[model samples]
Target: MPSIDLQETGLRALNTTLQSVEQKDAAYTITNPMGAHAIACGLTHEINVTIEGHAGFYCAGMNQRANVTVKGHAGVGLAENMMSGTVRVTGNASQSAGATAHGGLLIIEGDASSRCGISMKGIDIVVGGSVGHMSGFMAQAGNLVICGDAGEALGDSIYEAVIYVQGTVESLGADCEEKPMDEEHIKSLTGLLALSGINAKAEAFKRYGSARTLYNFQPDNAGDY
Candidate 1:
């Protein structure tokens, strides 16, 4: 495990160290990484980068196969548009976290603000806390697992995305619906939780997703939407 103190190191030094990292057994630990933007962006190597503190926007943007973990809260778009691998935030996340993520596993152990997982393509988001309104809006394809409460207008205008809510949903979106929990969903939820190191009973959760009513433009329902 290679430890790099971000306090005594520049962002370039930290990033350079991470970029040159090729050892899978190495844990490039960065301590006191406060609000460092693009800390590990465009990393194609398979490595584990752990930050002991907070990070700024696009912290792990465009990542290919690196796993990044933040032990503290993260700013907006924490893993914006990540390609592959995993990004885990142990604390709360700001707005638009994992926005437009194409592929990856984004695990938020705390509450997330609005537009979380907005416009996601194939990323999977598992949150242990609540999420703000309008989540999964215009989502193309993905899975959003919220173990806590959800704000108003959840899953608005969603498309081909599966949403699992364990708490109260203030309101369902334009064409979303609450569906019955089945064995398959329970297995899926269990897998997602286990992936994020969360322990919960899937039967205690509820599922919500697009009703396929607004998949295409509709005349009667499209007025308000």
Candidate 2:
């Protein structure tokens, strides 16, 4: 395992070092992040990275096969557009967490701010706490599991994505509606909960998804247009 101190080496150099490493299953510890942005973006190898402090925007954007863990809070767009692997935030996360992600898993142990999982594409997000408004907006494909309450307009204009919420939702967004949780959904939720280490009953969650009402042009629904 190697350690990189952000105070001694700048973020650019640290990321460059991580990018340059060709060893398989390497591990790194980053110290003194001090809320720096883009700490470990674009890592293509299978490695383990642990950040000791808070991180700024896009901490692990576009990551591939790297297990990145943030010991503290994260700024906006944490794990944005990640292709594979896992990014875990032990603390709270700012807005747009996991936005536009294509694959992999994003686990947030604490609360997430507005627009969490917005435009998500084929990614899986598990949030241990509440998420603010407009979450899953325009989501194309993926799953968003929220263990706590959801703010206003949850899943606005979402498409083909599945959302599981354990607590109350303040409101539902356009073309989004609560669906019955069948046996398959329960099994899936159970697996996701176990995978993310979230201690919640699968039966307690309610599913939400697109109603497919807006998938095509409806002449009778001209009032919405």
Candidate 3:
């Protein structure tokens, strides 16, 4: 295990060392992050990184095969465009928490602001607390599980991605509607919750997805466009 104090090492050096192939499988402890931006971005190795304090914008962006844990809150774009592995935030996250991420899991133990999983491709996001409006807007694929209440226009203009909310939803977005919770969905939610380590029950959640009505242009539905 190695420890780096961001106050002394600077953000550039910290990211450089974490991205090194020579440090494969190493465990690193970063102290006094003090809300620094891009704390551990672009890591391509199977290593463990622990950020001991709050992190600023784009923390762990473009991450691949690395487990990054933030002991405190995370700022905007947390784990944006990540490919694999895991990114866990023990506290709340700002807007666009997992924007455009292609794969892997993102676990936010606390609340998340607006656009939580916007345009997500294949990532699985599990939010232990509430999320703001338009959480899954334009999501092309993957699953988003919200353990708490959702704000207005949840899953706005969504695509193939699925959303599971355990609490009340203020509203549903255009082309997004609540769907039946069949056995397949129950099984999937069970696995996702288990992976996230959240104690919420799968049966308590309601599923939402695209109605496929906006896939093409139609004069009758033109107003929705």
lDDT of 3 at 78: 99
Give per-residue CA lDDT, model 1, range 1-225, as digits (tens).
Answer: 778888799888888778787777467888878787777777778899999898887788777789999999888887889888899999999988888988989999999999898988989999899999888887888789999999888888888878998889999888888988889988988998888898777889998877888656779866686
Q: Quantify all predictions' global Cα lDDT against the true fold.
A: 0.86, 0.95, 0.96
Query: Highest TM-score, which number?
Result: 2
Residue 128 of model 3, lDDT score:
98
Q: After superposing candidate 1 on the true structure, give the runs of residues whose Cα lies further than 4 Å from its correct spot.
A: 219-225
After TM-score superposition, what is the CA distance of residue 182 in candidate 1 from its true location, in Å? 2.1
Measured by TM-score, how close is model 1 to the native structure? 0.92
lDDT tens digits by residue: candidate 3, 1-225: 789999999999999989985566789999999999999999999999999999999999999999999999999999999999999999999999999999999999999999999999999999999999989999999999999999999999999999999999999999999999999999999999999999988999999999998888899966866
RMSD, every candidate, angstroms: 1.9, 0.9, 1.3
Give the C-alpha miss distance for residue 82 in model 2, angstroms: 0.8
Candidate 2 vs candidate 3: the TM-score winner is 2
The sequence of per-residue lDDT tens digits that candidate 2 reaches over residues 1-225 is 789999899988999998887788899999999999999999999999999999999999999999999999999999999999999999999999999999999999999999999999999999999999999999999899999999999999999999999999999999999999999999998998999998999999999999999899999988877
Cand. 1 Cα-lDDT? 0.86
Model 3 regions more than 4 Å off: 22-24, 221-225
Off by over 4 Å in 2: none
Clashes of 3: 0
lDDT minimum window of 10 residues, candidate 2? 17-26
